[model samples]
Target: MNEALHVVCPHCDAVNRIPSARQGAGPKCGQCHRALFAGEPLELTTANFRRHLERNDIPFLVDFWAPWCGPCKMMAPQFRQAAGDLEPTVRLAKVNTEAEPGLGQQFGIRSIPTLALFRGGREVARQAGAMGAADIVRWTRGQV
Candidate 1:
């Protein structure tokens, strides 16, 4: 039997099953039908962030960032690169602190560009700072 991996449809948020071998080749979402990552960060707002966090079976690396912070701006690409490198193994989500102050308060985020790693609906670890892709990868490796 072919092993299937579950990937969420970025368009309609439906679950899609794909052959595991297609991980690197990349695949389109099955529902609304769009490239899952499609060169964009997964969007999270106060309304749906908790739902995604709780329901996602995979570990999530969510960045708490805001638009005006230069450090956060500089780390955006690195975050995306890390997301790509760690795809399937790890999922990435983003929250704009300015936009979701309540979440920031809940997480006790004191700085911009805070990285939180969550698994099984609980926070496993967190760090605050800007880092390169390789460094982020290393940091995540120790998390699990």
Candidate 2:
């Protein structure tokens, strides 16, 4: 039997149980009927952050950024590209420190464009700086 994986919906924050073998077959959220992996990074706020972090069976990579930071703005596209390359296996998300300062403070994000990888609800790797899409994919894959 294929193992079931818990995936949190990027659209509705619904928890969907997906078969491991069917994850790459275009799964949709049970509650919202939206594609679970849309090849885009989810914008995370405090309200849905913990659910995505703890409930997802796959590893989660969060880009902690702010709008005013030039590096963060530059890396935004790369991060989005990384999302397209990494999704369905690894979940990619972003937290704007300017909007969610508490999350930044809670995670000890001292730098913008920090990439933090979490597995089993715990941070397993952290990288601080702007990186290309390939580098992001490589680093995330290496960590998980």
Candidate 3:
């Protein structure tokens, strides 16, 4: 089913292989020997986002935000804190709409802070507006 994944280490950014069967048991990087799943929000660029979404079997909560938006800026630190708390269980990521206009347009992102939960490259749920860390955690509870 092409379920195998190559997860990028957040610590050293090294790539590691994760068998699909072991997704919930936890996975680790071969090079740095750290958990391959950082369990927090990882930065995704235009170049790597697609690959990451395609490969990782874990559920993803992605923030589609912009640098210029006031709410987006305000939500950034809360999102980061939430990421740190959720790490390794629910994969968190951020997509900067201003930096990736093509992706934003593709996702039909009309707001500054839109979030989507993805599994196997398909989105199952989405939300918009700035959110507190507690709300973020609650919203993502069943998503993963």
Model 3 ranges off by over 4 Å: 1-6, 11-15, 18-27, 31-35
Per-residue lDDT over 3-39 for candidate 1, one digit per residue giving the tens place of the 0 to 100 score: 7666665556776777777755667777776776554
lDDT of 3 by residue, 1-144 (tens): 747766666666566777776755667778988777654677888788887777665677899998889999999999988887776656788998888898899889998799898888899899999999989988888566
Best by TM-score: 2
**True-structure lDDT of candidate 2:** 0.96
Please provide, for model 2 over 6-117, each residue's C-alpha lDDT reduced to its tens digit, 9 standing for 90 to 100.
Answer: 9999999999999999999999999999999999999999999999999999999999999999999999999999999999999999999999999999999998889999
Q: Can you tell me which runs of candidate 2 are displaced by over 4 Å?
A: none
Candidate structures ordered by TM-score, highest first = 2, 1, 3
Candidate 2 — which pairs collide? none
Q: Report lDDT per candidate.
A: 0.81, 0.96, 0.80
Better of 1 and 3 by lDDT: 1
Best by lDDT: 2
Report how far off residue 120 is in candidate 3 (Å).
Answer: 1.2
